[model samples]
Target: MILTVDVGNTRIKAAVFEGNTVLENFVFEKNELEKKIEKILEKFPNCSDLVVASVGNIDKQSFLTFENELKIHFLTNEDVYPFVNKYATPKTLGIDRMVLASGATLQFPKQNRLVIDVGTCITYDFIDENDNYLGGAISPGLRLRYEALHNYTAKLPLLAFEAPELYIGNSTTQAIHSGVVNGFVYEIDGFIDEYRANFSNFIIILTGGDAVFLAKRLKNTIFANSNFLLESLNQTFQYKIDND
Candidate 1:
């Protein structure tokens, strides 16, 4: 079995896979990562391989402790993927993005694919039809947009991300929600339109904590795979095993 962990700014997600099949998956608050890892270890005693793709600050010592407990190889960026990594600063690239791109390549071989991860920040990644990982963009996420407004300015109140009824908001709270949520919808739709015009038969995959919320507003059809990163990590393991 393969254990995949994705530590994001707000949360840590872990999954156990038996070969290519995901057996169980769960998320933990960033502060509770070690506790969750211990629970997962206790639940799955036979996990043989581990892979971590973190996008936030993580305690390397805790990860090392877990690795020692399991007695399995923990995969990281030092390991190569099945496809060529064209990122100029590969070491600086977020491991989650790399793992997600690797998963996208495996799922859509010889096809153009766009991966949008909507979490603390929105990350857009593109993998071309030739199996090349063409990097994309990153922008503040829905919640971050709201938080920034509240944090940066004195008057703007902290608002939760909610669906706005109209583009023109009637109240301050509604205005903030509209600006963040509807703006993201338009941003995503416009991006898709432009990308579709350039690439033939392009595929869009949406994942991350707020994926469901954003997916509800997206005008374009997209494949919503919540466990995409985990799947990607699993694919990375398979690629390593096959290549070796």
Candidate 2:
């Protein structure tokens, strides 16, 4: 089994993969880093390779602190990728985005792919049929939208994510619900529409913490899997081993 971990802005998503199949998945808060690694190793002692893609402020020493004999592999720009990154500042490009792009390119070859990650932030990354990594957009997440409303104005209370019963909100809470939830749904569909206009037979992959919550609400058709990035990391790890 291959241990794949994706360190995002708010959480660490890890999974155990047997070849291309994910045996199990795990999520941990920053404080649970040790337990996270321990649980994986305890369950899969034979796990020999650890593949990580981190976009958070986690210290590299943190991973080394574990007493596992597994070989660790961190996905970085320094590693060779299957896609041609065309971002203006390739060096500054987030590894998460590239990983998503690579996942799309390798998983859905010879097709235009648009990946929408709805986590701490909403990220849209597009890769053409030729496997070229082009840039996309980033926006506030559901929590940020709610937090912004509360922070910016005193009257608006901090609200959790919930689907409004009706599109037209009647009360103050409902109004916030409609404005935040519906607004985000519309924004996501809009982005999909914009991309669809340019590319034909495009593959849309939606994956992140909020993916399942928003997937059913999306108007456009999408391949929804919250564990996609972890799967992508596993794929990248396999590619590295095969090439090595």
Candidate 3:
């Protein structure tokens, strides 16, 4: 069995996979990292291979302790991957992005793929039909836009994400919602259009916290999977296992 861990900025996601099948998945607050790991280990003692794709700065010492206790090979970004690493600064590349790209490669082995991750920050990554990893764009996310409005300006109240009634909002709160949500919808559509024109039959995959919310509003068709990163971690482990 493969134990996959995706440590994000606000939360930690863990999954237990038997081969390609995900048996169970869990999400916990970042503060409860140890407890979550302990629970998983206690519940699923058969988790033999551990793979982690972390975006946040988690404690290395804690991870080391867990690896020693579990007696499993903990795969990190420093490990080898199946796809070509073309990022100019490979060391600085976010593990979440790498895992997403890895997942995309595994899902569409010989197809041009675009992966959009909408979480704390929106990220775009591309992998060609030949399985080469070409980097993509990153922009502020929905909540970031809301927080920017509240933090950068006076009198602008902090807002949470909600679908707006119309494109043109009549009031302040509605206007904020319109700007963030609609703007994102338009931006994503525009990117899809541009990319589709250049690459034929491109597969787009949407994953992250805000994926469901944005997927409903997207004009383009996308394969929406929240467990993409976790699957990627499993794939990464499989690659290592196969090659080793």
State which candidate has the highest lDDT: 2
Assess the local accuracy of residue 227 in candidate 1 as a C-alpha lDDT between 0 and 100: 85
lDDT of 2 at 67: 35
Off-target runs (Cα >4 Å) in candidate 3 are 72-77
Whichever of 2 and 3 has more lDDT, that candidate is: 2
Q: Give the lDDT ranking, best first.
A: 2, 3, 1
Q: Write the per-residue lDDT of candidate 3 for residues 1-244, one digit (tens) a residue.
A: 7788888877888899998999999998877877788888888888776667777878756666677656455555677777898888888788788878887888788899999988888899999998888888999988889999999998999987889997899999999999988998899889888899999868999998888887888989999988888888888778777776
Give one digit per residue, the lDDT tens place, for model 1 in 158-224: 9776788878999988888888888888888888888999999789999988788778778899999
**Over 4 Å off, model 2:** none
lDDT of 2 by residue, 1-244 (tens): 8888899999888899889988888888988897779878988998888888999999887787653578888899877778899999999988998888888888999999999999989999999999889899999999999999999996889999888988899999999999999999999999999999989979999999889989889999999999888888888777766766
Lowest summed lDDT across 10 adjacent residues in model 3 is found at 68-77
TM-score of 2: 0.97
